[model samples]
Target: MTVEITGIILMFLITVLFAYPLGKYFSKVFKGEKTVTDFMNPVERFFFRVCGIHPDESMNWKQFLKALLTINLLWLVYAFFLLIFQDKLPLNPDGNPGQTPDLAFNTAISFLVNCDLQHYSGESGVTYLTQLFVITFLMFVSAATGITALIAVLNGLREKTTQNLGNFWNIFTKTITRILLPLCIVGAILLVFSGTPSSFDGKDSLTTLQGDNVQVSRGPAAGMIAIKHIGTNGGGWFGANSAHPLENPTYLTNMLEMIMQMIIPLALIFTLGFYLNRRKLARVIFGIMTIGMLCLVIPTIISEIGGNPAIEKMGVSQLTGAMEGKEVRFGPAASGYWSTVTTIISTGSVNSMHDSSMPVSGVMQMLGMMINAFYGGCGVGLLNYLIYIIIAVFISGLMVGRTPEFMGHKVEAREVKIATLVTLLSAFLIKGFTALAAYMVAHHPETGWAVQPANWLNNPSYHGFSEMLYEYTSANANNGSGFEGLGDNNIFWNVTTGFVLLLARFIPIIGPVAIIGLMASKKFIPESPGTLRTDSWTFGVVTLAVIIVINALSFFPALALGPIAEYFSLK
Candidate 1:
């Protein structure tokens, strides 16, 4: 328990130290004020000339918003086609086709919306070409979404005086082409070097321990892993998640994966601060996120380290840690960290089986997903936090009997409504779908579905309920990481859960961005005595509270059936 707490603290301190300078660099990228801007200037001008665009003309809100909407729609259509005809395409080693209609729709929407849900293993159902196509396309769209939103926010700032349409496009393109893509490329190469496979060949024959021939699933795994972390898309090329040696491979790959997973989200905070010309505001948001991360992670480590005494009495060695569903190479510390990171960011990638985690550890991961997964990707996380910050600052105003303001902007009714909606949407999806899944698990047994003795249904109690609730929460949050105990590939999971993926992902992005667009339209309000300085700890506590209340109300009953029951029944 003590060691886990120490590791949790170390992770926090390390994240802060590493995150600050990275944020500084991203700030330069967003502001378009760095020395690199000079190098990009001529190239930018040449493109403008080629396209017959004037370098001096700024883009208005309408133009920026239009470009965002159009690009996403196009990506959605393309991804849908590719997913639907995946069987007809090449690289499927297992010779699987798109059998289920709902699965096809679910997968298409998942990748389109940047959610990347995986019901089957990638190496089995998908060809190498398909894997590469999905990976590359996802990286582009996910990175583009982040970069575009950021550009909008930056342009919104400039809209106060100048809305350079050319400048906005130039910034957006440069960030995607120059920064995001190149970084992902380098990250991918490093992952390959760390032993993650990057190949296009079909499955290879392998001799199993039982002297049986097995077809080893293979694909463009390394290529996908690079952007997977960069874009914060957690889907893996293999169904074992990151636990498979070929997928994660080595310690160096593990570290790289961790860094890549978090780098963008952390860096964007600095970018946000630098763009707003208020480092303090960025720190407040980052600090709040960091604290939330620790609150979840600390207990997770403790849950794993403390071990289950009942299991130990059966001669299971606690010293080896909770080995069930965890990779031997990653061990407790690394696996626990990865779980926390994936859950917090909405990445949903796993190096371990989340279901097999100790009851309390599992609960901690769930709480993080329900709370902070809002600011999940690069641009989205900070933007989501910003909306909440505005509201928090506004509330702080009334408490002290003063007008609350954020970054010289007043928190008006519209902003408040938008923030509330965005925050509540995830909660609604998680709870609503959870209820739906519970109704199924309870009703399914009554319908005489054959139940295997070893299945989650064997318990016919809270454990069974836990399996269903976990599946629902995992799907709806777009946190594709799963409990692994439920038979969710049935028609019920395919259709209802797919709906959760769409809502969880698209709603959060569009909702907050609309608020950003709205915020852009308003003139910056000057700070006065009543304006709350959100950088303080008091506001941080409130921000944390807001997240907790939302999750508690939404997931309280389901969690009680799941982890709460497991914890109490352990004795």
Candidate 2:
């Protein structure tokens, strides 16, 4: 237990160490200041020239969003068709078939939104061409899309008043060329050297030591795995995800993947400080997020390491804790930590099956996604936190006798409305969708879809409710991890969650960026003696309180019916 605890601590600390400097580097790259990867300037220039975009041209918030939506729509159309007809494409060494239309819709939108929720397994869902061209390609671009939006919002905040945030095309291009590509190349090389497959060779059959024959699946997985972790895009190259030996390989790879998933989200927070010259504010935000993270992670580790009490009554030894759905190389403690980290950051990649975890651990995992901003995903983490910050700023002002202001601009009714709507929108999508799924299970079980609603869940009653709730929460949070017990590959789940992915992924983004833009256009009010110090510990406490209160109000009831009730029932 002590050794396992130590490993988790070291993994977290190492991620922090890497994130700080990388964050600084990211700010430099965004600012166009000279850095190690300045050699990519020519390549960026070539792309801008080919696309006929002037890198220096700035855009208003409306123009920025329009371009973002337009390009994304085009990408969606392109990917959907290719996935539908993947069997006709090249790179299918195993001759895998194309995806059904509904599944293709889910898979395409899932990747496009940075959600990466796989209703279909990676090995046989589509061919290698689609995996590389569609899946791997979207992993890079979707992550860059999130980071680019973060930079754009930061631009709105940093200036006292400015109509133009940076150019979307420019920031997006530079993010890929300088940050994501270089890191992925290095990460892919490490994985390839460490025994993960990087070839296009088909499956090879081999007899087990017991003389049982089986065909093993392998592909160009190392590269996809690299982006999957670093980009926080969590669809796996194989069905078992990181739990598969070929995907994770060893304890060292486990540690590496864990660190990669977190570094970008953490680094980007520090980059906010550098970009805005507001290091103090950044520290306060980081402190709050870390505390929130600890609240979720610590309980999870303890619960997982304690094993299942029910199993203990069955007279089975559980000295190593609950090992039911976990890799032995990465025990319960590390698996618990990964579960917390992935859900919190929207990575959704799993080293173990979440369904096999204890009830308390399930609560923590769901809460992490419910709050959705503790550490968040690649670029979306900061964007989501920005929403909470605005709300906190407004509430703090109301408590005192001052007008709500963020940075220099006054936080008006407009900004507050947008923030409140975005917050409530998450609850609505999660609960509304889960309720619909539940109603279908209870009342319309014989509707006879691809998989009947009667067969949607493997576990009966309370545990079954959790599978449905967790799915929508994950969809709403844009976190792609699942309970694995849910029969969710049908048309109903695929189509329903596809639409959820679109709205949940974009509305929060649109809200924050719109707030920043609106505030930037407002009059800048200079700080006075009466002003609230947003960078102070006091404001940080208020911010954390607001987050806690809102999460409780928004999610506690639904949670009570799911994991919380299930915990006591098990007792």
Candidate 3:
């Protein structure tokens, strides 16, 4: 237990230590200041030139969003066809088949939006060509897309009053060339040396210790695994994700992947401080996020390390904790911590099966995704929290009988409406879809539907409800981790989740950027004694309170029916 506790502490400390410096670097890179990766400017310029994008030409918020949406649409079309006809494409050394249309739609949208939710397994479902060109390509660009949106927001924040945010194409190019690519290359090298395979060679026949033969599937995984972690795009090369020995081989690799998943999101928080010259504000936001994260992490770790009391009553030894669906190399504590981190960050990669975790641990995991703002994926973390910040600022102003303002911009009806919609949409989709699934399962079980709810669940009762809730929650959060007990590959889940992914992934981003843009266009107001300072510790506490209160009000009922119910039932 001590060792497990120590490992979790060390992982977080190391992540912070690395994130600080990287955050500074990110500020430099995005702010167009010179840094180590300045040499890559030539490559960036080349791409811009070829794409007919003038790096100097800035855009208004509308133009920027139009470009973002258009490009994503095109990418979606390309990826859809690629998945549908992957067998006809190159690099299928294993002769993997193409995806079904519904699955293709779900997958293409998933990666394009940076969700990376895998309804289909990688080894048997997708071809290597699709993996590299489609999956890997989207991983880089989708993450860049999130970062680029935040960059636009920062541009809006930095200016006292300006119509132009920045050039979307320029930021996107630099995000790939300057930030993601370099990190991916370095991570790939480390993974390759750490025994993760990087070759295109097909399956290798191996003799087991029992004298039985086995065919071990292999592919170019190191590259995908690198960005999958660094970008917080957590779809695995294998069905088991990081739990697979080939994907996560050792403790060292596990530690590295864990750190990689968190480093960028954490750094982005600091990047805001550095870029906006608002170190105090940054510290406040970071503190609130950290507190919220630890609130989930600590309880999860305790529950996981304590094992299940039910099993104990059955006269079974659980001294090693709940080891059923976890890798021995990474025990319950490590898996528990990883579960917390992965869900919180919107990186859905799992080192253990979330389905097999303790009920309380499931609650924490679901809460991580439910809140979906504690150091979220890439740039989306701060963007999501911006909604809560807006609400908090408005509430604080109301309490003090002052006009609501944030960073010199008035929080009026327009901004509030958009923020509120973006915030509520996730809850709507999660609860709405879960309720539909439950209703279908109960009232219409024998309808010969593509996905009968009765056939879809691996567990019955409360845990079964959890599986349905977790799937929609994961989709709505754009966190791709699953309860794994849900049979979600059918057309119903694929199409339903596809719609959820599109709305959940894009609206939150668009809403925040639009809010920032609207605020940026407003006249700057000087700070006065009556004005609420967002950078203060008091405001930070208020922001945290607002997040908790809102989430509890909105989600507590749905949660009561799922993990919370399961938890009580277990007791």
lDDT of 1 by residue, 503-543 (tens): 76666666655665666666777666655767777788887
Candidate 3, position 314, lDDT = 96
Worst 10-residue lDDT window, candidate 2? 37-46
- Backbone-clash count (model 3): 0
What C-alpha lDDT do the candidate models reach, one value each?
A: 0.69, 0.92, 0.92
For all the candidates, what are their Cα RMSDs to the real structure? Answer: 3.5, 0.8, 1.0
lDDT of 2 by residue, 508-533 (tens): 88898899998998888999988899
Off by over 4 Å in 1: 1-18, 35-63, 91-94, 157-171, 208-211, 373-375, 444-460
Error of 1 at 298 (Å): 0.8
Which consecutive 10 residues in model 3 have the weakest lDDT in total? Answer: 445-454
TM-score of 2: 0.99
Ranked candidates, highest TM-score first: 2, 3, 1
